[model samples]
Target: MEGELQRRVGRNLRAYRQERGLSQEAFADVLDVHRTYMGGLERGERNLTLRSLEKLAAQLELDPLELLTERRER
Candidate 1:
């Protein structure tokens, strides 16, 4: 379940980044994370902590719940 959730969150992050037309480097800067870490996050290879999620949502202008949910952009 954790793996699946991670994958979904990774997909959501990629989708949101694409929607905003931001490169991973730019997005990592905005999120205050290393580019490699962001890559891992997007690849579902890392388990993000709650604090990490909060920080990411704050940077991304999204609610925390948005990160927890997986829905294709409309």
Candidate 2:
């Protein structure tokens, strides 16, 4: 279940980033994380801490809940 949440968050994060015209490498740079690490997050292979989530949300100009939202059609 946790893994599933990761995937959902990752998918949403990717969408949000792309919508803002940011590449994974560029976003990673903004987050001060390695590009590979950013990829892992986008692929749902890495878990993010609350601090990381907050930072990312700040960068994206969104609320943290926006990142966690599971927008996939049921």
Candidate 3:
């Protein structure tokens, strides 16, 4: 379902944001999105468009696939 994908992407994005030491506000600015929209995205309440994803990935200096990838367990 869309909700599940949102959660996955949201979780991944949150992790990536933390790893890069970005505050939600700062990251949102970098992505050219509103702070509340960024909050919604982090909460899995917003659906992501491809362009939005591309901008986010670019801001992170990452490939789009990297943002979409799940981390492996040891």
Candidate 4:
């Protein structure tokens, strides 16, 4: 369940970043994190802290809960 949630968050993050036309490296810079770390996050290989998740959502102008919720196709 934990892993599934992580991947869901990663997918949401990736979608948001892509929607803003930002690359992983650029997004990482905005988040003050390493590009490799961003890649890990997007790939769901790294676990994110609650604080970090909030920070990411804030940067994307999103509610933190949005990052956790799964997205469905319209």
Prediction RMSDs, each to the true structure:
1.2, 2.4, 2.0, 1.3
Model 4 Cα lDDT, one tens digit per residue, 1-74? 65998898888878887887999999899878899999999998878999999988888788999999999853
Give each model a TM-score.
0.89, 0.82, 0.78, 0.89
Q: Candidate 3's error at 47, in angstroms?
A: 0.7
Candidate whose lDDT is highest: 4
After superposition, which runs of candidate 1 have C-alpha atoms over 4 Å from their true positions? none
Give the least accurate 10-residue stretch of model 4, judged by summed lDDT. 11-20
Model 2 C-alpha lDDT per residue in residues 1-74, reported as the tens digit of each score: 65997887789878876877999999888778899988999999988899888988887788999888886643
Better of 2 and 4 by lDDT: 4
How many backbone clashes can be found in candidate 4? 0
All candidates in order of TM-score, best leading: 1, 4, 2, 3
The parts of candidate 3 lying over 4 Å away from their true place are: none
- Across 7-69, the per-residue lDDT of candidate 3 in tens digits comes to 777888778778779999987887788999988998889888888888888877889877677
The lDDT of model 1 is 0.86
Worst 10 residues of 2 by lDDT: 65-74
Q: Predictions ranked by lDDT, top down?
A: 4, 1, 2, 3
| Stretches > 4 Å off in candidate 4 | none
Residue-level lDDT for 72 in candidate 3? 62
